[model samples]
Target: MVGVLERLERLRAAADLVAGRIPDALAGKVDDVLARSNRRLAVGPQTVVALAGATGSGKSSLFNALTGTRLAEQGPRRPTTATTLAASFTATNADLLDFLGVPRRHEVAPPEPDMTDLVLLDLPDHDSTATAHREEVDRLVRVVDQFVWVLDPQKYADAALHQRYLRPLAEHREVITVVLNQADRLTAVELSQCLAHIRRLLDDDGLTGVPLLATSAVTGEGVADLRRHLSRLAAGKRAASARLAADVTVLAAELDRHVGPARGSGADRRVVDDLTRRLAGAAGVPVVVDAVRDSVRHRGTLATGWPVVSWLAKLRPDPLQRLGLGRRPELESPGLRHSSLPARSAAAHSQLSSALRAVTAELGEDLPGPWRDAVAAGVREAEPTLGDRLDRAIVETELPAERSPAWWTLVRVIQWLLIAVVVVGLGWLTLNAVLGYFGLGVLPMFPLGPEDGLRVPVPTLLVAGGVVAGLLVSGLSRLVISAAAGAAARRARKRLEYAVAEVAEERVLAPARAEVARHDAARAALDRLR
Candidate 1:
């Protein structure tokens, strides 16, 4: 009983996961089964065994023989029973009878303890010409805890019976029985042949191992054996549990066809990586990385270049700041500041879409239709906000701008010293020229070297060497700045990619993985039912 309840709970959970996703027909059928099982379970522990058959099959006669009373109307008419009639040894199963919708009920005198637990039902002919009669049979067939298919010798192999009931209910063989009614009419040899033939037909209908009995409601032949079978089932008091369990198992199997097998593991890592890469591109990470490098070089050159010309570098705008990115903003801002980066080109957008589709396909390849659709829907739903999310990531990221290399400061100091030397040399030269021009006393000037035999004044050499050295230092500073900027760009790229990956996980991968998880859970529940 514990196993039975557990299986039913699993089936219910599995059904909930795919409630509106599967075919409407299957979903409706399962819901009906669940509803009926719940009502039956709540009713009581009485084992409601139904006697079902076609017209003139003596189903009602056998019902009377089993109960040892003529509760159900039995006659030679083509269709004697149009409504379901239930007979129990005790009158306490009114709720159970009400649930079964059998208004015509009768109570027999107290019987043996085994018989007291049984609620026997006599049902209408399954192949009746009247629709209501057939409907009643179908309804009672689903709700009953056990079935005794009564067959006369003439229609023992009825195609309608096998096609309509036995084959469709092959999963409930444990709770089903076949009784060859009116066996007294057949000689021993004929009975043996007929039983053998019926067994073969039942086997063909996948009803192997279902109990077969030869009963005569008129002569009471094989009636005691039928009673003993019902008595044992009633004594065990597991017929209701077994019947409901089988119903759940069959419904779960039907649902399994729509859910497919459990996924071996979580979403594929490669698919997630590919999705993140695509999202990064769409979010403009590459563009931001390039801007970071360019911004770094622009700032570095201004810091380290010769003071006389360093102001020229400042004239150009910082690439990152121009984009409204590269720096963190106030925490209270509603939305992150938009970047000046250009919108993605049509080709880039197309590539991003293709990548998203690839991820969807990879994740949903082996999933059932409903689950695959769920995954695709999740990806598409997340796509609309991807651009904004990427922008937010960029706004929140910290660029390498606040700190400068010590080398820039050292070079700036050296360049300033060289400018000072040039300034001093020019001042000395100007003084001498002015004094000589005014006919005042000429200042003594030192000649450090001679170029082509012409004496070169020390002051003139200082001015010329300082100007030339400053140019060389400026050129070297450009190279250093380029290298530093390249490193900064690589670091920025890593940070941006990490941010993009987080967004991908939150918006895209998370939803897709959730669908997969539901699929896995549903499949696991189906396994328990099996």
Candidate 2:
């Protein structure tokens, strides 16, 4: 029961969320659906004995007879009720009737304490195809705890009654009561035969376990027996209203399963998840993280005469094209008789409206003004703008790190190496000049100075030194950068896991949790009402 209520709560919350955001008619529909839900929750769960039959069934007579009141008008003529008729037992039950939208009239019953708890509804002639009539009967049956299917002797086995009402509401068999009315109009022998025939037809209708009773409102025969049964039902100590509410809610939820998970999902969240991951990768977090680490390890290398390398490391990558982040995602493919999220969302919203249409149809009242306004507010609150929301979500996203250029360090290292080579070459050139001035030159590769033999130019030696430094720096930078990049990739991947997890919680998990909480609240409210 708790689980069932929880599900209903979720339905109510979802309805509330979409109610105002949808179009006018849609909002109106959702507003009523929620109202009915609350009414179902709050309606102190009485048993409804719906008086059903064709036009001449004298069903109303039975209702008046059972309560011992002239609540329903009777005639020697046809169609006493031009519209669907109803009279409930409680007056301060304004909230419940307001919930049900059956008009209020204080039709006094002749003081039967046994009848106080029972709300016997006098239904319209089922044969009448009046839109209003059919709708009222449907509304009554849905909320009613016990259905006392009133039938006349002649149309007791009517095909329309069985096909239209009986078969579909088979779930309410325990609460279904088949009353064979106008028994006094038949001879005793004929009454017995007709009762037997009705029983046989009931069996064929698969309503065998349902209680079938005989009565004549005019003769008052068997009325006490029926009243006696009703009295015992009311006298039961169980929470009848609570149980019925739970039952209706459970059935409604079962029907909701056909809608599937795609019904209430948000498109913004889906788009944002994919976008964040791609954007994070493109921002070059792996590269940036690696460089920060390497810079820390070789902190001295940059601080002490390696400003060039450090400066080059400061160049950030292009955020968009770095990891295919610039490309747009493929739109959901088109299909025959199938649709994408936008299309399905439209359909689902439409379906949501259609599902709730029965609520107003039953009650025969326009939605209360506040409720309609609230529904509009809710729809506006839940309005989906995947692009706008996605952009905002992206703007808020924090990448773990920003990567500098891969070649920047090499450029810096080469600059330092060039400086070292120039100094070395200058020393060598001065040594060669001094040695040649006194004929003691020993230039390692070319042993003689300019004066002693064939000499190397000082500028040429400097150039050679510069080439050596450049080559060494290039080779070393390649090795260092490789190691740095790999380490950065690993760290970035780990950090990215946390980022994704956080975003998922914010966008997906958080919304889902809220949905669950709303459902639980609704379920609790409904249970309290019950």
Best by lDDT: 1
For candidate 2, lDDT tens digit of each residue in 1-530? 44435555655655554333235664454355455656665666554556777777888898788877777877644656655455555553656556556673354552456656656667777776576777777777666556778888877778989988887656556667788888988998998899889888777776787788889898898888888877666555222443354455544454233222221223244444443443333333344444445443343233222343444534643333233222223522211111111122454444433322322122212323333333233333433432233333332333322445545655765666686777777777777788889988568644336687777665557757576666566566556655664565466556654554454345433444444333334344334323
lDDT score, residue 39, model 2? 67
Candidate 2 to truth, TM: 0.52
Off by over 4 Å in 1: 265-274, 328-334, 424-466
lDDT of 1 by residue, 1-530 (tens): 35777877787888888786689998888888788878888999888999999889898888888887878887787888878888887875888998989998888863456788888889989999999999998888888999999999999887888999999999999899999999999999999999999999999999998999999999999999999999899888999999988888788778888989887436677877887788788888888889888988888878877778889978888888788775544535727367777798888799789888987888788998888999999989988988888888777777775467788888888888889889988999999999999999877778765566878787887888898888899889888788888888898889889988888888887888888888888888777677
Residue 238's lDDT in candidate 2: 29
Q: How accurate is candidate 2 locally (lDDT)?
A: 0.55
